[model samples]
Target: MLTRSFPRLATLRYPLVLAVALMATACGKGTESTAPAASTPAASTAATPTDTAATPAAATAPAQTRQPGPIVPPQGPAPVLGTDYEEIPGGQPWQPEPGKVEVVEVFGYICPACAAFAPTVEPWHMKLPADVNFHYVAAPFGPEWIPYAKAYYASEQLGLVDKTHMALIDAIHVKKTLPGEGDPVNEQKIADFYGQYGANPKQFLDMMQSFAVSTKINQGRQFMQKSGVTGTPTIIIDGKYRITGGKSYQDVLRIADHLIAMERAAMAGTPAAAPAAAPAAPATGTGG
Candidate 1:
C-alpha cells in the first residue's frame, strides 16, 4: 500500500514548477532591447512575429501628387474697339487703290509704345499678302520726334533697316539708352551701332541729311496729320482705318483680314456668303 499524496500539494507543485521555469528563462535573458537567440530547431525555423499593422497603415496612406485639370490663364478686361478721335474712312475701305490697304504705323522713337509694337509688326510685315502694303510713318509730333524720323529715313536709304530697326527698339527699351535729339539725327551714334551691319559711317550720315530723306519725313508727318492721329503707335490700315491703342493692334489685323477677303471678293466680282438672320438689329460700325 502506498502512502497517501496530498491533492493540494500535487496541484501546487506543477504551478510552482511552471513559475520557476518562466523566472529562469526571463533571468537568462538580459534587460537589453535585443531578442533572445533561438535554441530549438523549431523555434529557429519559425518566423518572428511583427506588429505588421503599421506597415499596412503606411502603405494605404495617400501619396503627394499634383492636381489634374486644364490650366486656366489670367483674366483681364476685354479689348475695346475704336478711339473717340476723328474718324477718317481709309477712302473706299475695301478697294485696293493706289495707296489703299496701306498699313502705316505712326511711331516716334522716344515713345516706348512704338518700340514695343515694332517687333509685333515685323513678322506681320514679312507675311503680308500682295493686297496689303505696309509702311512706317515716323510721327514728327514734336521737335523730339523729328530727329528719330530722320534717322529712320536714313536707315531706309542705306538699305540698313533690316539690321537697325530692331536694334533701335532694343537700344531704347532694353538698354535704356537714348541716341539724343538733333538735326541729322546723330549719325555717329547710329553708325557705331550700324557699322556692325557693314554700313559706312560717312555715307549713312550723308543720306540721312539728304533732301530726299527729309522729304520722306515730311510726307510721313503729313500722312499722320491727314489721318488725324494725335498719338503714336496708330495703325492706319488701307488708309481707311486707324487703330490707336495696344488693344487695337489685333483688331487692326482682324480688320485687315476682313478687308483682304472683301478685296478678293470685289476682284472676283462675287458676293460674300450671307449670314443667318439675327433676332436683333446688328451693330454696324467701322473698326481698325
Candidate 2:
C-alpha cells in the first residue's frame, strides 16, 4: 500500500524564473521570425567596386561548391542523477510494460512549477526513443485539485489530451485563471475552457465528475505517495525512480534520460554502469 503525505507548496527560485523568462522570449522570437528569408536582393547590378589597381589577367575557375554535412542534433549536458530507485524494503519493484521504459510525470494542474516546466518538457517528449512509454499522472494533492485531475483523465478517455493538455496549461499559467483554486475545483469552469477546444462542455462536465474518472484521480494520488513524491512536477521513471523539478527545469529531463538508460540496462539483464555521486536530499520538493 502507498503511504500518503501532504504536499509541500513552494515558489520557484530566481534562477529558474530567469530561465523561464528567457525561454519564453526565445520561443516568441522564433515564432515571429520563422518565415523564409526574403528573396535575396537581386545581385548587385554593377561590377564589384575597385580602388584603381593594375592587375594581370587571372585564369577563370569554376565556382567552388560546398556540400552540406548530415544534420546533427545537439547533445546537451546529462542529468545529475540516474533514474533507477530501489524499493523501500518490501515495496514493489517497478516493471514497465513489455519493450518500453515507462516515464510518468506526477503533476498538479494548479502548480506553478508544472506550468514552468511544460515548455522544457516538450522537446524531451519529442525526442524520446522508440522503446519508451510516456504518461502523465495528475496528482490530487487536495480537494481543490480533484476537478483538474478528472478533466485530464476525461480528455485522455476521449483521446483529446494532445489538444487539451497544453491549452489547459496556457489557460492557467498565461491567462492567470485559477480553475483549480476553489471549493470543488470548479468543474464547470474547466469544462467551459475545454469547450473552446471543440469539446462538448456538458459532456466534459458530466464525465469529469463520473466515478470512473474520480477513481483514476485517486490512483494518481496513490501513485504519487508510493513514489515518495511530495510536490508537483515530480517524475517517476518506470515507477522506480523519482525525480523532482529543481531550480533548473532541465534537471527534470536530465533525470528522465538517466532513468531511461538504467531501465534499459536492467531489462537486458546487464549490470548498469555507476553514475557519479551527488548530494542526497529528501523527496520534499527541493528539486530533483
Candidate 3:
C-alpha cells in the first residue's frame, strides 16, 4: 500500500482528516464552501481503492481551504510566555530588514499540517501591518521535501511566489495534480509544473539548482535548528519566539497576534503588559 511507502506521513494524516471533517461541519452549518476550480487525478496512488483501505483516515483531502474573512483580532488575554510560546535564545531574523517586524513560518509543501494551515495563515499574513514582514522558510525534512523547498526559492527568485504560492499548495493537497506523498519525486516534473505559470521549465530547473537557492536552503535549515523548530506550520515571531502550543490553528494565530503586538509595542518604546500565567495548552498537531 502507498502508505507503507512513506511511513513518516503518519504524523501528516491527522491534519488532513481534520480538515475534511471541518469542511463537512461547515456544510452542515449551512455555509457553502467552494472547492478549487482546477481538478486533476490525484497524484497519490494511495488514493486508489486497493491502497485506500490502509490509510482510510486521509482518503479525502479537504475540498476547500478556509476562506479569508474579516480579520478579527483574537479576543482574549495576552498570550502566556511558556504555555503559549517559547523564547528562542540568541535567535535572529532569517533575513533582517530595518524597521520591519519579521514573522516567518517554517513549513514543508509535502507536510499536510502546513497545507491545512496555509489557508488560515495566508489571510492573516496579508492583513499584517505595514511595519511587519512575513516570510516563509520551506522545511526540508527529507528527500521528498527538498525539491519543493528548491521550487520555493526558485519561484522567489523569479518573482513568482505571490502568484504561485497558494496554487502550488492547491496542486499538491487539493487537486493532487503534483506529486506529494507516496508518489515518485521527480525534479523535472516539478519544473514542468511551474511552466504553466509562465516560468520556462528549463530555466526553472536551472534556478532550482542555482547557488542562490542552495544558500537559502542551507540558511533556512540553520535557522530552524537555532529556533528549535521541530515541525511544520511552526511560526517564528521576530526570530525570538517559536510558537509551541495552541488549542487550535486559530489559537496559534491568536498567540501570533499577541506576540506581534508585543513586538510592535516594543519597537515603538511602549512594551505591552506582561501576561498572567496560564496552564499549558495542548500541542497544535504540527506535522513532523
> Tens digits of per-residue lDDT for model 3 on 126-151?
77777778899986656667789899
lDDT by residue for model 1 (1-288), tens: 000010000011111232232222110110111212211111011111121121111211222222322312213322233421123655323223652345566666655434434444565565666555666777554444566677788877777666667667566445635452222345477656666677787776676678998888766756655665544455655655554322233434444454444444555678953312224657797777
TM-score of 3: 0.73
- As for candidate 1, its clashing pairs are 90-239, 90-240, 101-238
TM-score of each: 0.56, 0.65, 0.73
User: lDDT tens digits, residues 1-288, model 2?
Assistant: 011111112332222442343233211000111112211111111111111110101101121222323323223444444322333222222335786878777666665546555655644664677777778888665555566778899988887777667667666656545453332447788989888778899999999988889778767656655676544555677776665323244544655676678778888898976654556766777675
Better of 1 and 3 by lDDT: 3
Q: Which stretches of candidate 1 lie over 4 Å from their true place?
A: 1-100, 180-187, 244-248, 263-269, 272-288
**Overall local distance difference test of candidate 3:** 0.65
Which consecutive 10 residues in model 2 have the weakest lDDT in total? 26-35
lDDT of 1 at 284: 92
lDDT of each: 0.45, 0.53, 0.65
